[model samples]
Target chain A: MRWIRETGPVVGAITLALGVGAIVTALTGYSVPQVFRHLAVGAFGDWYRLAQTLTQATPIIFTSLSFLIAFRAGLFNIGAEGQLYMGAFFAAWAGFSFQLPPVLHPIVCLLFGAAAGAVWGFIPGWLRAKRGANEFVTTMMLSYVAINFTSWLVAPGGPFHGTAWANQTVRIATSAQFPRLLRGAQLSWGLIVGVLVAFLVWYLLFRTPRGYELRAVGQNPLAAEYGGINVTRNMILALTLAGALAGMGGAAETLGTHRRFIELFSPGYGWDGIAGGLIARAHPLGAILAAVMMGALRAGGQAVDRAGVAPADLAAVIQGLVILFVVAPELIRYFRRLVRRKKLGDIEL
Target chain B: MEILSFNLFISALRLATPIALVALGETYSERAGVINVGVEGMALAGALTTAVVAYFTGWPWLALIAAIGVGALLGALHAVWSVYLRADHVVSGAAINLLVLGFALFLTRVIWGWRGTSPSAPTMNAWILVGVGLFLIGLSQVYIFRTPWGLRLRVVGEHPRAADTAGINVYRTRLAYTVLNGALCGLAGAFLFNNLGRFTDGMVGGRGFIGIAAMVVGNYRPLPALAAAYLFGFVDALQMRLQDYIPSQFSLMLPYFLTVIVLAGFLGKAQVPKALGKPYVKEQG
Candidate 1:
């Protein structure tokens, strides 16, 4: 029964996505079946494509988990985008600045990224917990600050500047890169890390005392205080952890794929993670699945464009439709049942 | 120095006008107990609609009207989902943003055969619109404070159940204010496309978000919101003016940095509408 309830929304969402694909195909003058086939082929037809999809999905998993962790503690950490960028900047800095042994180098860079992200996350968390500030507005403002700060840091004549084609930082050392898990594809060890983090998050939320306290505080801080939970401490810890996860995602994208820190590397992945977390209702495993679906749409949308059927914007349409359908499954089901009943009456009468 | 000062003032006012309009729009929604996170998407849809209509018809006024109508329609969709259906207002707003973005992108590609819409637009005199926009802002401030409807709206925002007992139609008031909010945002978008003589993909780039920050810093009051918007515009103008002296990127970051500082400073003391993000469900006896 629990499984049925969970699958209900998922099935509704898939149906909605399919309906949208059909509409897009008709509008764009392409065959619906062919477009679907092309998307499948482009995303998972072969080993290479599957690897690409996994790689694309990896960073999102981390960021989505980050969002989940904070949300579980009743914190809306909208600064994840800024945190991710800052983490990437720090990781890139550490990667290029030092020449440590291969194993230690990557570890150090990852830690550096995590630390940078945590600091960024901690600011809003501290302000909100201590002064009763609204986290949403503060975090949103921080995102712009982070983006501009990073851009300035990487521009020519800045500290992190390299041989610049545009305003960007230098590439990291070869040893600093996350080791590739497969040859001829971009899949790296980051996917394993992302999966491990998801399991760890699940454990932390469900099996740990700290998690209980955080959840309690989230449910009702006043009551949690009566229960002897330190609400302020939990709030700060949750935001810091959330920031670390998002930062790691940023580091993974840089080390595994781009190999360099660039301005605007994220096409709003942090915001996408927020959407993914909300869709999953802050469940760890659910977030992983939701992130993958988002990643698939993005990865496959590229193929949809190449198939001479639709443009990249079609993917956005499908995404919006999926979210709408998921949130209001009853409406879709009701309409479908209405249509079916009408058809049945026509046949019998 | 004289040339630079003249250009800075113009650019500042130009940048400030749109943000001021959007923030003022949000002021009403927040006061009426709805958080309008779809401002970015609303602006995008409005700008795109204005560009397309103005391009074919070559009538700036009609295009402006179309933009406002479409924005209100989008707001209606938001109201139906968040207010009537009782969905999470923030999530509903996010869904609307994604929907509008997707729809705008699709329609732009289909109608213009261009990846992004960039139509040749006729220029409307900025001074006229700016003056009118400012006047409206002042009127909204006065109307929101001095009128019975304004008092009712505030009562609804602060405590919907109490307002309901007092015979205020909470849902209807919220719906009306949200629609009006959408119109103001649409006007801002029109200013971007027509006043600027052209529109780009990033024309309203993060101004919607900045407008939200302005509202927060302003404590949701109309005059203070305008002041915050002007402060942001001043920084933005300064950045452009000092582009020669400072690194352009750092200069560009000035407004955002100020947003962080201002938010941090004012957030602690800001008094939000008590029932701001809460939905009011009528009790069954």
Candidate 2:
């Protein structure tokens, strides 16, 4: 019953968002039913499509987990995007620079990437914890800085620029790459790692003493402090962990999917993580399903575009609408009040 | 010496116009106890409106009006979500940003056969808008500080229950200021269109967020906010010149990095409104 109660709003929001997508598609002179059909077909049309969807879901799983952990500790780590970029670049650097055995190489690259992301996360965490800075602004500003900084590093004349005309590093060594899960499919062991990490997060969040303290801080920081938990330390820990999660995701993308750090490759996976975390009500286990749902939308969106049914951008509209509806369940209550013709006042949930 | 010439000052003012306008708008909304992080989306929507309208109608003035209307509409929607529905303000604002980006891109592709750009359209002089922005900032300093209405706005934000007891309409005041904030963002977008003579998806870039940074740096005051925008604008101008000596990527980073440093410097010192981000409820007798 509690699970249903918590999940009811998210389910309702998804349905309504799809309805809005239909309307927008019709208004844009596309066949609404065809768009929906294509969306379904594109997402689960065949084994190949399913593999592609899972491939797309892999990175978001990491990012949403990053957001989930931070949100549980009352922090918003919007810098996940930047952290991901840093991780990707560093992972790529490690991939090409070393001559290690196959099993050892990927591990070293992942650690280097995670460390870079952790450092980035630590800066804002320290600032918020020690200097009383708002993590919201600092995280956002740092995202832009990291993006530009990484872009410069890979552009022509930079230290890591590849010989290729494209703005990307040289292909990472094969030994550093994650083994493909299926022949003739882009799916890699990265997805398996992401799932394992999700299980780890669920255990950490629900079955650990540290998790209790973190949630207590999120619920009421002053109360947590009075209860002897170090609120500041927890805040720093949450963001640093969040950064590590996102960084590992970036490293995975480079090693498992792209095989190199491509410039401006992310199509807002970090932002998608926010929506995914919210859709899951911040449950670590639920994030996997939410990520897969988002992946379906992206994959289906691309299919629709290819079929000329509708632009892929419609997925974004649906996503934004989902966030709006989820955050404002009061909208439903307001309509209910209007139906009853009652004067506006707070209604008990 | 060439980099520090009179042209730099002129260019700085031009670059500062949008940021100043956005800061001024944010000052009004934040002063009235609303945190509208959707300002970035509002400006983008405004820019899109100007391009779409101007492309079809060939009337710059009409396009400008449409842009402002679209911005205000988005603002009003945000107000409905954040203010009336008691949603998380940042979450609602993020939604607006995403929705507008999707809408803008969809419209561009549908109408122009391009993903995010439109052909050059007839545009009015952006400097005129800059001049008007300066005047309004000057007037706002007085309007926000000296007027009874301004005091009412402040009172509503600081202590809404008291303001309610005093017969002020707290909800209405919040709604009105948020709408005004949206309109100002629209004007900023229009200025961008006029300056560039067209529109691209990335035209607004990070200026909207930078504008919020300016507002914080200004301590939520109009005149000081404009000054903060100008300072950012000057750095922006200087960075363009420095691009020759350094990598453009590093040069591009200066403004964002500076914003982080400046915000870190100002965080706890800024006088935040007491009722900011809280949903006010009327008690029954």
Candidate 3:
């Protein structure tokens, strides 16, 4: 019952988006039911499909929670893409360059990833906290810096170049790789760790004094300040924490899946995470389910193209619409109310 | 003597054209108490519209008018949702950004049957557009500071209640300016492709976002924002020239790095309009 109530709006949003998608599919001269059937089968047809879906979900779960934390503090950290790149790059660099005990190697690499992301995150947080800079613009500008700088770093003949022709770093040491969870499958402990982080974030936000201060700052900063909470400090702390989570996600993706940092490592996973946060309404634990839903869409995106059902970019369109509906639920409600009024009077519909 | 070269000056103006128009548009909307991050999307859509019109008809002026129409339509969509429903300003902007991006990319395949770029179209003389943009900025400065309509718009941003009490329709004023802002952004988009002579994927290249930063760095005023746009444009041109002396990446990062430094140093002193980003409830107003 609780789950139903919590996901009520998300379900409505998905339904609306699918309705729009169906219309689009029809316009392309395809059967909507067949397209959806293929989508479901492609995302969850077998054990292999399930693993692919979960793999697609893990990183977004991490970044969505990152957005969730910053959002709860009334700060928008849209720079998750930049932080993810920093995290992935540094983690891969540490994984390849370091000589450590097998067990310690992965841990050190992951830590470096989080630290790099934190530094990236902290810049905008500090600017917003100490100065009055809007993180929206500052973080965005820095994202280009991150993208171009990373591109240059990995370009052939550039620093951090590996032995390959591709613009990427050397492969990580075997000891640094995440242990696979299943035989013949790429699934690893990374998915479990992602879910665990969600729970931990929930505990931190709801059951701790510092979390209370963060929420207070988010809810009413002037009131929080008047009540003796250090609003400025909490704002910076929340954003930094958010960045750390995104960094961890990037590390998990690099260490668990690719085992190296490559150019265009993310297929806009950061933006997908932003959509996840909105779908979850900034709830930490809820981000897990939202991430999986997004993952299925991503998997379905490929399926539709392969099956000749629709364009591969249909997922992007649907995700965008889902964000629209979720961010402004009132838009749906207002339309619904108008429909009801019309039905009660002249029955316009 | 070389620093004052006519070629360098022209290149700087060329680089600054899109950023200048976007910054001016952002300044207007922000002053009207609406934050429209959709400038990025609007600009992209406008560019595509320009490319399509220019490619098929070879009429650059028609493309300009069409781009403004597209921008206004998008701006109206934002205004209606934000003004009436009081949607979360930033979130709504992000939604528009996402939807417009996907929609524009999807249209490329449908219209041109090409992959990521449009066919190179003929470009017209763009010096007239740059002159028009500079003239508009100057005119807007005077109109905003010295005109009665401009005072009403500022009052709506700074104090909606005062504007309401003074018989000004705050909602209508905000909606009007927001639509106008979109038109300006559309103009900026048209300039981008017209100057470049073609449309490429991701051609806006985050200039829409950079323009927003410039508006803030300039204290959200048109004159200062125009100067900020030129400064950013100068860095872009300087970076290209510095490629011979330094690693190109370092040069590439100059504008962004400088923007951050400039923002950090200036933001604390910059005061946004008081009612900015807040939805004005009719009762409260």
- Cα deviation of B194 in candidate 2 (Å)? 1.6
Quantify all predictions' global Cα lDDT against the true fold. 0.80, 0.87, 0.83
Candidate 2 clashing pairs, residues 3+ apart or interchain: none
Report the C-alpha displacement of residue A164, candidate 3, in angstroms.
3.3
Best first by DockQ, ranked? 2, 3, 1
Better of 1 and 3 by TM-score: 3
DockQ of each: 0.53, 0.72, 0.65
Q: What TM-score goes with each of the models?
A: 0.92, 0.96, 0.95
Per-residue accuracy of model 2 over A34-81 as CA lDDT, tens digit each: 989998899889989888889999989988998888889888776788
- Which number leads on DockQ? 2
Q: Which of 1 and 3 is ahead in DockQ?
A: 3
Interface quality of candidate 1 as DockQ = 0.53
Clashing pairs in 3: none
Model 3, which residues run further than 4 Å from truth? A1-6, A25-34, A182-185, A339-349, B1-5, B113-115
Worst 10 residues of 3 chain B by lDDT: B107-116
Off by over 4 Å in 2: A333-349
- Per-residue alpha-carbon lDDT of model 3 for A120-172, expressed as tens digits? 88989999999877887777777778877887888876888786779888899
Cα error, candidate 1, residue B42 (Å): 1.1
Q: lDDT tens string, model 3, B1-285?
A: 455567776688878878888889888888889998888888887888889898899999999889899988888878877877788778777778877777665556556656447887867677778998899899989988899988988899999989998999989988998898889888888988888887776888778888988888778788888899998888888777888778787788898888888888887667688998899987832
TM-score of chain A of each: 0.90, 0.94, 0.94
Considering TM-score, where higher is better, how would the candidates rank from best to worst? 2, 3, 1
